[model samples]
Target: MTEEEKKTADTGQQEEAKKPETSAEGTKEQKEEKASADTKPETEKKADGKEEAAAADASAKDDKKASFFKKNDKKEKELQDKIDALNDQLRRQMAEFDNYRKRTDREKEQMFSNGEANVIEKILPVVDNFERGFDTVQDEDKDDAFVKGMQKIYSQLQKELTDLGVKPIDCVGKPFDPSFHNAVQQVEDDTKESGTVAVELQKGYMYHDKVIRHSMVAVVS
Candidate 1:
């Protein structure tokens, strides 16, 4: 070969070696940049995961607080309802007791009145017998022992009746009142006033200030 052709061939060989080295360096730089970009994306994903976990924990704590408060409020309402029921029951019991007391008092009063009436009714027959014995005795025998005995019995009966809150109505020589006296006969007399009682045929008795029997009387006009 010629000398110039040989020199050109040697230079071309050196350039070929330099070109391979530059190509290898450029490939290594590109690989390093791509690896750096991939690592940055992984770091950002880790930060987002941590934030999501924190938010979930906070939500769980809030739910627990709400549940506790709801349970407490329900218990408080149940307790209040029980208290109100107890108060209503107490009031009803008190009212029942008061009504029972009033009824008992009324029954006691009625029993007392009935007892007094029974005693008075039993003694009325004895009073009637004494009156019949006194009426049978003649007025001319007023000083006789039998007549005096009847008077004594009548006086004793009068005293007994007075002690028992009983009294005789005075109808003779008084104005005739239908409330206290029953007129059996009417007579015209100049010596007496009109509508006045001339004589009492039967004595009237009062028990506890109330009239038990009206006096039988003769009225003069």
Candidate 2:
């Protein structure tokens, strides 16, 4: 109603509106800090979960690599075993072939020796007849052309027999061995020892190292 009283009331209203409220501002700041604190724990838990998943994946990869290496080692061992078995089989086959070759060679040698001995045995009688015929020739006829031709032929026959590994056995004036000499008669001889060959009735022949024919002889008693 009075002018001064009205003026004072209007100034009080203006000051009250301009002044800040400390209690309301402090309460709003506290609520914002609590929201930030609550969000930090969730972010950290997500990071931890991602790290655990990465470690598990790495372990699985390592196990797979180890399995691959183990399989390769098993395959190598199997291949080596097969190679060793093949080598052993080849060695056994080579040894068997060598043994067979040696056996065949021995058989061939034995057959050849038997056949040569048989042929030489049949030819011995003809050689004895040739010697007997030569002994009957007279010394007066020795210079004749026919006798000379026969002597040359006999010499050629002896040379051929010598070339073929045939040789006459010594009987007269040598010891009488039953293997090489046949004693047809026993006689006394002062010039020779007892059981010695005094006379050779028929000559013996040897083919190589074998006696093809035995000498017919008279032994000193």
Candidate 3:
């Protein structure tokens, strides 16, 4: 063979030996890129799971807070209702007590007035009898035993009437009052004023500071 042909054959053998080493390096680089891709997907999945758990926990806390507020509101409303009822009851009781006190006071006043009227009524007839006895007894016989006895009886009747809150109204020489004096006779008298009481014919009686009977009087002009 010629020397140039021998050189070309040796170069072809060297290129064949380097082909296996290049193929092995390319395979190792492909394996590393595949492993990196797989690890990125796993990391993303873990981050998504953590975010979902946080959201669930927040929702649970909000629900618990709402429940607590509702319970507290219900309790407050119940307490307020009870307080209002108690206040209303107390006001009603106070009004009842005031009414009772007023009624009792009125009753007491009426009882006292009634008692005075009753006592005066019983002694009125005795007073009338005394006046009749005085009219029958003469001034000349005033010193006599019968006259003295009648005077003593009249004085005792007066004392009894006074103790019972009975009083006599003076009509002689006083102005005529329709409330306390009843005109029984009319006379013309130049010495006395018109519509004035000149003389009292019958005694008037007052019971418990109130007029029970008016005096029978004679009016003059």
What lDDT score belongs to each candidate, Candidate 1 first? 0.86, 0.87, 0.87
Q: What is the lDDT ranking, best to worst? A: 3, 2, 1
Candidate scoring better on TM-score of 2 and 3: 2
TM-score of each: 0.48, 0.69, 0.62
Sort by TM-score, top down from the best: 2, 3, 1
Candidate 1, residues 7-114, lDDT tens digits: the string is: 999999999999989999998998999999999999999999998999999999999999999999999999999999999999999999999999999999778866
Candidate 2, superposed: residue stretches over 4 Å from native: 1-69
Where is the poorest 10-residue window by lDDT in model 2? 15-24
Evaluated at residue 75, the lDDT of candidate 1 is 97
Model 1: residues with Cα > 4 Å off, grouped in runs: 1-97, 135-153, 173-175, 191-193
Highest TM-score: give the candidate number: 2
Which candidate, 1 or 3, has the higher lDDT?
3
Q: lDDT tens digits, residues 1-221, model 3? A: 88998888888888877777788888888888889899998999999888899999999999999999999999999999999999999999999999999999999998988887876776677788878877887779889998888788789878887886788888898999999999989988899999999988888988867888889999996
* lDDT measured at residue 31 in model 1 versus the true structure, 0 to 100: 92
- Regions of model 3 farther than 4 Å from truth: 1-66, 139-156
Which candidate number would show the highest lDDT if scored against the true structure?
3
Residue 39 accuracy (lDDT) in model 1: 93
What would the per-residue lDDT of candidate 2 be over residues 30-122, giving only the tens digit for each residue?
888888789888899889988899988999999999999899999989999999999999999999999999998999987897788787778
Q: To one decimal, what is the Cα RMSD in angstroms of model 2 from the true structure?
A: 5.4
